[model samples]
Target: MASTDSHSCVVYLVDPQDGKKGTVVPDRFRRLAIADGCGVVGLESADEDGGSQEELTGLIVAAIAAVMERQDPAELGGDGRAKVGAVAKQAGFKVTKVQFDEAWPKYVDGLGADDEDKDGE
Candidate 1:
């Protein structure tokens, strides 16, 4: 589910705790700090995109779908969780993993994956 939505903008999301110690940041715009996805790779991920971008764009798509559905991608089951862990190492998300058989689904198990699950995987 690569999005060719030409109408787009990058938004930087910062955890409040990561702010300068005691510094006050006025509520501002929201942004995505990702690159190598769909179209337009941000400068942030430019240096890191040295041939390791497999499924990175799909990861972004899945993540967006999860948020839209109010589902936490990390807590998803089967294929969803498998895909999440696959990109965790590269995407820099500190998540735990189980065995391979457990990580992936037994079959193609389409449908749910049509919502970007398999593509993301």
Candidate 2:
């Protein structure tokens, strides 16, 4: 999601069940998360830029986890989104929600392409 002013983009990795918030990490650590649940991660572009989308996503997720781990548990309570936002802001990215209406077509196209690839195989 790009900020209203177009300065930054936000990606939300919210939990579908209880709206638990997080981001995408590496395969090895994501496997661990399957059992332990995802921890929050936020990354700023200034710290380091990844060469690929996968690398950048992994960095964002790891940073969120690191920031959350340092916070006081009692302060976090049930307000996971707030905590995630705080971390993201501190990292220098402005938070903004992406509109589902605008985003859905890209997802559908991607999924369709994936299906076509499988059919070809």
Candidate 3:
């Protein structure tokens, strides 16, 4: 296993059955996460020039736990779309329902992908 080095990585410590909320994972401990049940988005490791290295592209954005949920697109109409879209749109693409639906589960590094296909829920 690789140690948590200068290059950061988000570690979402999540519990799907729990409430939905996020918490920060410090840079030093960011690279550390244990789960087939969490979402991790990488940020760029800032450099002296206010940018990061080309080689070190992904930095730890956040580390959350016991809170990641498999978001359903139908639930977007109420209010959550804005929150999810912020991240999806940041990728520099037009945010659409189809795209968001596909991307939501992957955000958790396949945590939601497992049982969804098997249980037919």
Best by lDDT: 2
TM-score of 1: 0.20
Choose 1 or 2, whichever is better by lDDT: 2
Worst 10 residues of 1 by lDDT: 25-34
lDDT, candidate 1, equals 0.36
RMSD of each: 15.0, 18.5, 15.8
C-alpha positional error of residue 66 in candidate 3 after TM-score superposition, expressed in Å: 18
- 1-121 in candidate 3: lDDT tens per residue? 1342445554433534454444455544432332112234353445432232221112111111111233545423464432434433333223345544544444555445655877885
**Per-residue lDDT of 105 in model 3:** 42
- Cα error, residue 90 of model 1, in Å, equals 14
lDDT of each: 0.36, 0.43, 0.36
lDDT of 3 at 102: 49
Worst 10 residues of 3 by lDDT: 58-67
For all candidates, the clash counts are: 4, 5, 12
Please list the residue runs of candidate 3 whose C-alpha ends up more than 4 Å from where it truly belongs after superposition.
1-84, 110-121
lDDT (Cα, 0-100) at 18 in candidate 2: 55
Models 1 onward score TM values of: 0.20, 0.28, 0.23
Model 2 gets an lDDT of 0.43
How do all the candidates rank in terms of lDDT, highest first?
A: 2, 1, 3
Q: Compared with the true structure, what per-residue lDDT tens digits does model 1 show for residues 1-121?
A: 1223334443323335665322222222111222322222333454545322323334444443443355555545654543444434333332234322322332223336575865786
